[model samples]
Target: MAAGVARSDDLRREPVLPPGFSLVTLRESGDAFGHAQAIAAEAGAATLVWVRRFDIVEFAVVLEPDAILAEARLAHYLAMNALADALAIHSPPERPLLFRWPDALTYDLGLIGGGRLAWPADCPENQVPDWLVFGAMVRATTMSPFQPGQTGVGMAEEGFEEVDAVDLIEAFARHLMLGVSRWQEEGAKPAARRWLDRLEKVTGVRHGIEPNGDLVATSQHGVERKGLVEALAKVDWLDRESGGPKL
Candidate 1:
């Protein structure tokens, strides 16, 4: 698998996670997504890997779904919905939180971070994989000097002064659990609708998430679909070398 920056081996204190979640906290330089992937199979479901950093809220969780890989990927939408919902819980009211298609998250028109999903490479699409990993990163504080044309904003810079990394992770976990329950009891429609409602809208186009997790856009030109798996494989928001959000 293509990986990110190699982080230091220094470990950090663990945070109090919800029931069924086992936390593995890494140092500031460690990559939560990468670490989670490395141990996903043996770590079992609900194993959460978190990176301790002052500038970013980075974490990933392991999931074992009963559905086939194709349909199971729709869980990504649930994860995104839960994430956006978590941010909304703490964000200042009226701050617009939006998603840039399959992955990236934006706050007030500025990029914050995004989510990513991964499964076993050898697992067949028709079979339910042994595990799936969902990871997300949110910019809590800006490490670089801001430029005039900068396109991203940190949580701190957006009136989320009281929110911290732990708070976001906790909220995300609870919301994610709620999303999963809703998916199980009420079906995927609720999760799908939550995601679609927050998607960046185009005036002339109508957007919807397919049952298999693809994005379908309808317009005068007819309908177009984008594969969720293909887009996730590219992980547009990740800086391959840095193992962090794109700057």
Candidate 2:
């Protein structure tokens, strides 16, 4: 999947991205997250890598956080919260938005899709990361040209209508900018709260994010903290057998 720089004689003609940002359009088959990470140091912050696809909104943004990687994991919450807000605006009001901790978004009870994050390999946990890429992909269309069950998974099978991927991406970009701006002005705690509000609010369970990006949940009976960094170490969203999203 090759990538091409968006061509515009005047930089002002670019998309109305966050205050200072640039766009890199990738082929539909390209991996936005992988490409963003590959060019993170050079592209710098606010460089958005996107795929122009009809079926799904696939893209990721590069961020230059001022906080250490340990604390900056909270940035994931910022992105997820922004995404949920954006989805809420464009999708059916009844379509539920819930997270599977660290990273994973579910529509109603069925798994739709979620976001993934990547940073420089050499960047230490205590050091402020030079660049970080938060990528996301949502299944918009069924993509089942023939038999629906044969594909194993399809958005239509999951019962989402009227929502397409391209519009979702545009809305998400706008919301993400707003969410990040809030993060800059306020603290991560408020951002975390906003994210928690969108997630499935489990009764009798209090949720919080640790400094190192781990997920903490306190139950009336006991408190348990799931390691976000560790959970991210494994790829849970994609199906190993089918090589796509799991049903």
Candidate 3:
């Protein structure tokens, strides 16, 4: 796939987008995250790159943060919470939408998909990078046969047959806008709190998201922190060979 934003001159042909945002649709084989990151410097901000695929909702957005990279990395939490909230809105009211630490998303205890973040590799931690790319994918349909003990589910398999990929992408955009506004108005704590709420709770451990997006767990053994950047480098839900969620 070409590593750049899809030509935006055809904005008139794009779907209705939220204010300050533009859409760049890609073919089924495109990689939304890579394209967004590749052209992030020229795309400016609020450019949403989406891949048209029947079995998954794959998309990425370009962001230009005002804060330093150290502080801005926390925005990953906002994006995660927004994604979870978007899924929750269309999911069954009783269905539990949970998060696995920094990125993975789960529904009713079954693996769904998750979000990812990318910035310039050479960018300093305390400096503001020119752009940040947040990408996410949700399994919409399972390509494989259902096993006797499968632990993963697609949106269609989870009773959301009527909700298509476009619906989820639009929902994510709207929710992400709200999340960004909340962070702008009240700071990162609100987003962090929301993320912590959805995080899979571990008994006897106090969970918190550090300023740099690390996952912190405080217990009787003092404190432990997991680097969000490191965790993001290896997405647990993805199958490297298939370039899709693990089946």
Candidate 4:
């Protein structure tokens, strides 16, 4: 990893980025999400902050939404949808991509990574958010440098081949922009449908999103919908201990 860093520094001082997006390259030691959230107010929309590293691909995108916090969170699903779509670009055909609801993403039935949201503490739920930040991270390669066959977290023991970290991030940004455009043109319904399609399909459970930002699900013959917001609140994101995703 240190060698990669030295090579990157010697190669180009500026990071290559897509159109309409500004890049903020952080030192390999910096936290992409925390940094983006701290400066989102000034960074504005589509500002992508990424940490150039060898073992992981960590990045965040800043957004200025027109809706209040309540409804704005639906954008989280859009971010995940974009992520899955982005991975599909490099994955083999029929590689299963699924979302574990509210948060967490998987590839080919293996836990890979997920998206998260952040906003200012003072931001009011009723007032439209000035800026909303969506961030994501994926483990590109295991750090068990000496033992290539050693098992690691989740199903990461089965490594992906021929794919690089930057490819996924770049693909995600492009797909996310497309999702934002789709939401504006058609509405959240289309986005919701796309998100639902990628969920880990469960039998006999009918799922739907309420207008006020709750995900509701019920058994085929059930009488009421189960509110999913409560479940989503307990996500072990930010790994309270390390203040980052529980890798």
Cα shift from native, residue 181, model 2 (Å): 1.6
Model 1: worst 10 consecutive residues (lDDT sum): 1-10
The TM-score that candidate 3 achieves is 0.91
Please provide, for model 1 over 1-247, each residue's C-alpha lDDT reduced to its tens digit, 9 standing for 90 to 100.
0011112221233456779989888877888888898999898999988888766788999989889998888889899988898888877787789999889998887888899998899999899989899999988766655778888777766776466677778889999998888888988778888899999889999998888999999999999999888898888887778666676
Report how far residue 8 has shifted in candidate 3, in Å: 23
Q: Could you give me the TM-score of model 1 versus the true structure?
A: 0.91
Model 4, position 39: C-alpha lDDT score: 91
Query: How high is the lDDT of residue 217 in model 1?
Result: 97
> Least accurate stretch of 10 residues (summed lDDT) in model 4?
2-11
Q: Model 1: how far is 62 from its true place, Å?
A: 0.4
lDDT of 3 by residue, 85-132 (tens): 878877877878999877889988888888889988999998998999
lDDT of each: 0.82, 0.70, 0.82, 0.70
- Residue pairs clashing in model 3 are none
Better of 1 and 2 by lDDT: 1
- Per-residue CA lDDT of model 2 for 1-247, tens digit only, reads 1011112222223345656778898765777888999999998988988776544567888999999888887888888877776666655457677777667777775566678887777889899999889988676554654364443333544554445544466677788788877888986888777777766778889888766767788997898988877787675875656434565
lDDT score at residue 168, model 3, on the 0-100 scale: 70
Q: Count the clashes in each prediction.
A: 0, 0, 0, 0
Q: What lDDT score is found at residue 235 in candidate 2?
A: 59
Give TM per candidate: 0.91, 0.83, 0.91, 0.82
